[model samples]
Target chain A: MKAKIGWTTNRLHSFAGITISLVALFCIPLLGSSYYDFLFSLALIYSMWALGYNFLLGYTGLLSFGHGAFFGLGAYTVAILVTKFSFKPFLPVIGIAVLATAFLGAVIGYLCVRYTEVYFALLTLAFSMFFYALVFKLYYWTGGSDGIGIRPPDLFGLRFSAIEYPAHYYYITLAFFLISVYIGWRIVNSPFGKALQAIRDNPLKAEAIGIPVRRYKWYAFIISTAYSGLAGALYAPLFGHVVPDLFHFLFAGEVLFATLLGGYTIFLGPIVGGIVFTVAKRYITAVTIYWPLVLGALLVAVTLFFPQGIVGTTYSLLRRKIGIKGGE
Target chain B: MLSGVIRPTHGKIYFMNKDITGLSPHKIVKMGVTRGFQLLCICSNLTTLDNVRIAILSHMGRIGRVFSPIDRDREAYEKALETLKTFGLDKKRNLLARDLPHGDKKLLDVAMAFALEPKLILLDEPTSGVSTSEKGKIMGTIEKVIREKGITALIVEHDMDVVFSYSDRILVMHEGRLIADGKPEEIKSDKKIESILLGVG
Candidate 1:
């Protein structure tokens, strides 16, 4: 336990940091670079996805290589609702997607949460691939390999024109991103979150001390996949497309890579990683066809030198050098 | 077997008037049969107080509260402090459990189980890894806690001295079959028990 810091020091420090970050995010689209706004919106979506992933990676200590299934599940649900079913409401479509993905997450998590390490990761991978196969085979409903296009649904009857939709969508994604961060922060600081960490540190010990290790892992799995679903739904209109590749293991690896790059342990690590990785990948691909090689090398470098990822290492260094208040 | 770590092949497990046979470890613990392992198994990264607070929180049914911050739970904090104080570990509550000395680590493990408010605690070699000089003090603290709380303690120990000193009744098992069940004095005076455990045949 840290020496009890003053209320002003503890609360004000994190509060001010959050305010500044939120303000910066709220104003990203106003920079007059429409292209930058588009990239930032994509980055924001991935950030939310990575934030979900962190629940498993950072707190619950489950390494899932199949979260792309939830993200893809979300994207396809919204795409199907819009294109096939002709659903028009924004919130309800996302709501249904969240509920559906959470349902699937619950089933899969119940099975996978009982295992750990490679077994847990592999089990999640199997389920994700199973989901990918399901969507790919149902060509009439899911568009199969042809994928599906998304028509931006009405936002409470105030529909934006094509020219302004991108800018408006940025704000919407930012709003959800802010909410996700706040809730994520709150959940991690809660007793449930501490219990998850305890399970991660020592499941046998956690069980002996009365923490239901497997059940809590399942809970974390549901929470994370729901967030993934939400991120995927939010991403549909932004990308204007849903594809089966989103559910593939490779895409899951990308999400995992971004999370590790940003700093999975620190609260905001995955968010930063998501933003940087998405934006960096876009630029890197445009620059070279050898993008995979470059990215793979970066992943290796980060894993070797910065195991805590970028934010975690920097937070520790700052705390050590200047004794700055990073966080608990 | 009583804590439901493994199923008992031959008998039922009735804890506090409930059939808790083959229940999950957490459910068994929730029913008031908490356990401590032979090895130190506290959540080592967390502070000593937080480790105890987690058990207290579980006992209080606050482990599932997602909205409330862990540190703000006054009842859990105070109760955890009380459990720590019982083992004389409150002074080192600020330190991480893994960083504690060997004896204190053993003490903290039992303290966490105590925090769960177990009606019956099953301790496996509670003083196993501690120095011989500190073993008596650790056992004394644990004995005091069990006595004060009126907890039915089932301590598994291999130390002859600890067994002779602490036990009221003794059961001797040879080759996985119970050979003796009686008061410690009776077991001490039994020729069969002396032949088996004491190797005085």
Candidate 2:
């Protein structure tokens, strides 16, 4: 009987998530104007990046401030591929971008995985700054502070560029976002996920039990970076441009905030947080240039009272109420 | 054979014949060495079964292979069940590790270490906070593992009775230095051991 309930609950959870995702994907194209559709695609892109960050922060309990380096590396791959090689197929370029970013992540993860908590974070941040400096100094390839622009190409065999519509780009972005979320879900449910969480709870205990905690961490970091790179690759085509800002500290902070605001525990939290952030930024920026002040105040309020973030707080409250009744 | 946790410096260690002197704690663990904390380190949100299952999964070939129910098949379940039964915790397998009593948490932590099947397992204060009656049970479990599995165990414990009961050999530390080493009976009667215990040496 209990097993039946567990099965039912699992089914319900999967069904609800799928339903919501489908609704959101379909509704965005219908409800929004062309400009809003563009903004929505950007939000999906950012959410993909934030989800990757959460894989490290939420699961492994390792806070990284250099995820932007991976994101920029991906964008740089796309820019370099398009400009230098005139890469015909988008799939191969994105694949290369993922591989390059994963390699970079492995190197950075190897160096920083030894540090604990705050030191790990600081090491990653230092790595990010190093990359940022390298990119800026080598102006010839990176195009320095000005950034580079690339025209969207035909996706696979489809004449996606021929349509040249925001809606078409929205669908592409949505497909990528869905795939990224699915991959993230797979990682989070796997034995690797269990090991990652074990490390987070207690690294020393985890190791003593014969878990190679450092190796698992490096794998997590590389996987997260690969997802971030995939997101950035999608962003390049969606925006028709790639900029140094993708590598900036502020951009990394934005991804962090998105992860927090959405609630790290729930897979959908980062996506919701990204959408909210993008919408809030758009609406608030139109109203006043001092939007950061307003957002900062809101963030402070959220932090102090709803420390678990929106989705997390709601889930806890619901669990308490229902769980108590169920126990009775 | 289990490698010794050789301290090269303060807060730094070498494990399994590797210079893990400045390596991250996680990296040190990945090299097949881990220490059980005095406090419970199980994921508070997960069940005892899940916690042990996580340990078993530490050696999994790939992260992508963990999703299927087949990943946690009869073998993994049996192993987890066996570990729990050995610790007298099979009945409470479904309970969250956090919901366990202090003594049980200590045992569960050790069980988690055991699940990893490490060549060398380090237990820091394993008998600390355990009741007198519970101490025997915990010690029995550790001894069973060492004897039956031939797994090397390094237990840094404060309970003289528990330590002396299970240890094949003993090393006494004073002011972070190895003060004495011999058979348990010899160490128990040594002047240096007495002085260290009585604070007279």
Candidate 3:
């Protein structure tokens, strides 16, 4: 038996890096303004969404172009429950949102997983567009394109005014984001995650080895969308409204962009990518009206050059600098 | 057709008294029929140990246990280790599948099938791309494991020596038609098989 190389020098380096970043994250609200707090929370929410996306795209090798539907589903579920039914507590709202999105994921993933590669991507986009149309046309329930506004949720009867709400919600989003990341880490390192990676690496081999590939993909899809739904549920309160645009393909593209920018192969890639993209998008748009053009050019350059992604490229360079060959 | 990667146009496949024709590859695998690919199709990005562990996880129905760490499951990890040792790949357990030589990759493929603990395994090419010297050793290891596990194997091989030595029965196909099926000695001596297989009468 091979001696378990449980924590090698490379893993240790990453662990240290993660620790420092986490510590810095804990200090962000104290050191920054309310605007910075708001932006950081938004980034954390997107990071949560991208983490789930990576499970499919990065780990399972399934490119879904309609995850916005799941995101919108969660936001809509929360909006309708709070507005229509006057659901006050945050826990049950998130719970219902997750379950509802999982159901949607099940239905969509059922049809979508039957196809792979571009076909799978297109199918997801179709479903997302379908949801966007539903939200846009059904003005009575969904409020059409105007969307539904949400009040800050009470936690066990503790409520805050508008001034205190963003910071309170910032902490909440940060907490959920950390929990989601930890859960995602546990998941990807588990036997389940390895099987997904195996399926990603070689579908033929995974199937021949008695893995129910479609079933696993379906499971991954549901899990991923569940996380996205959770992110949306949290996001609705933070943003003060849920809009039909949440279901738009453009939003899905941004999520995909974040995953790609972070390097989906690494566990922490999406988090870094989400934070960086949010910050960059905010700053770029402020500087010029041609922000989309600038973002598009940068994306093209990254895709053409740093294909492995920011985390992947940096790790490779670091390994090379130390004269260490890659791989276990 | 049997392993369900492809469907036969005209016939049904019966395994363990059930018809499994046109079933998906994974469904066929669940019915105790699995395969090793002609190409080295082990997960190249993962370690040799992880490659086998994936198969074991699938077999044990623990691939859905997302909350639990694989390392915490000592039985599964040990079983994967033992499977690798069975194929003489335990020493290279930490090495990624892409880094292993052709022969070891072939053995890892077979080892992956063994992890499934299937009743029947279809080996596409057990010794393809392996060096001449390493062929016998790899084949011997695979043959020994198959015997020990009491699993039936249907191997597709063009090497006459390997076919004659490793197989109890033989099958020959020409233009997708079964031209011959018999004991190795009978097929070896047959004029039709000799002309088709050896290119000589």
What TM-score fits each model? 0.92, 0.83, 0.93
Q: B-chain TM-score, every candidate? A: 0.95, 0.83, 0.95
For A1-328, candidate 1 gives per-residue lDDT tens digits of 1112323455655667767887898888789887887889889999999999999998888999899999999998899998989997989999999999999899999989989999999999998999899889988998889899877888899785324667888888888988888798788878898898888888888998888888999999999999999999988877788889999988999889989998887678899999999999999999999999999999999999999988888788876996665243
Number of the predicted model whose DockQ against the real structure is largest: 3
Residue-wise lDDT of candidate 3 within B84-167, one digit each (tens)? 999999999978798898889999998999898999989988888888899999999989999999999999987878888999
lDDT on C-alpha atoms for all candidate structures: 0.86, 0.75, 0.86
Interface RMSD of each: 1.8, 4.7, 1.7
Ranking by TM-score: 3, 1, 2
Better of 1 and 3 by DockQ: 3
What DockQ does candidate 1 have relative to the true complex? Answer: 0.63
Which regions of candidate 1 are displaced past 4 Å?
A1-9, A161-163, A324-328, B182-195, B198-201
Q: Clash pairs of candidate 2?
A: A114-B24, A207-B34, A208-B34, A208-B35, A212-B30, A213-B30, A214-B26, A214-B27
lDDT of 3 by residue, A1-328 (tens): 0012254645665566667877888888886588888889889989999999999998899999899989999999988988989987988989899999999999989888878999999999999999999999999999998899888677778795324656776787888988998898888878889899999999989888877889989999999999989988888887879999989988899989999998887777887888888988999999999999999998998899998788778767866887544442
Candidate 1, position A174, lDDT? 85
Rate residue B71 of model 3 by lDDT. Answer: 71
